[model samples]
Target: MAAAPPPPSCCLVALPPHAKDGLVVFGKNSARPRDEVQEVVYFPAADHEPESKVECTYISVDQVPKTHAIVISRPAWLWGAEMGANDQG
Candidate 1:
């Protein structure tokens, strides 16, 4: 069976501009599908490296920019993210 589509909303909670300390604490907890496994992958920032190919879930783009480093957890068979942490944080 195919997966269901996402709900029609941005996932953030909407709050009035004047609301202060209304929702300072937030967290997430989710379970991976039983058929899938995930692993951690890191992409280092290389501003002056030769142009190369990047393989994504559906297609291969000929040139992709890697100006900022990132660490991501992803499925072993796919070339995308399950969760990611950027270089800054």
Candidate 2:
């Protein structure tokens, strides 16, 4: 028998008048191979206290004196964001 088709990856955005708030929606289907590994991570807010540093990479830079919280979904062995969203206001 022939193999079945894969599911579709989709995203939806609802927009109204500029005076009103809108909504955003995302849905990922069977886009990646089943053997691959992905992880969803949550980063809490720093509140701009002693400042945040960039130690997650191979380079060094200035500290972030101000920042917000965020969540990212990326590869299991890499520090990259394939999909991410912020929880800030």
Candidate 3:
């Protein structure tokens, strides 16, 4: 079988520290249509189930000041996330 194609290319920017009005903002643009992009929240945690084989590469609960809410942009057709920010910031 042929391999699945990669998702659309995207550009992301985290606003500078000196952003106007002192607001911290993140922006992203992707070649995918707006209809296929979505906003979601993930409560990240380790998969401790013995039978499960998935591993999380991002933050683990024990490795931070504390875990916080994760707000993210997700692609409708893929399990991978596009971009996100935590409540910590």
True-structure RMSD for candidate 2: 5.8
Model 1 TM-score on a 0 to 1 scale: 0.52
User: TM-score of the candidate numbered 2?
Assistant: 0.56
Worst 10 residues of 3 by lDDT: 58-67
Superposed model 1: Cα runs more than 4 Å off:
1-28, 48-51
Model 2 C-alpha lDDT versus the unseen true structure:
0.66
Q: Please report, in order, the local distance difference test score of every candidate based on alpha carbons.
A: 0.66, 0.66, 0.60
TM for every model, in the order presented, reads 0.52, 0.56, 0.45
**Clashes by residue pair, model 3:** none
lDDT of 3 by residue, 35-59 (tens): 7757576766433443434334543
User: Which candidate, 1 or 3, would have the higher TM-score against the true structure?
Assistant: 1
Q: Give the per-residue lDDT digits (tens) of candidate 1, residues 31-76.
A: 5565787787889987644667767889977765556799887778
Q: Candidate order by lDDT, highest to lowest?
A: 2, 1, 3
lDDT of 2 by residue, 1-89 (tens): 99978545555444555335564445555366678898889988765546455755466565677656788887787665777778753
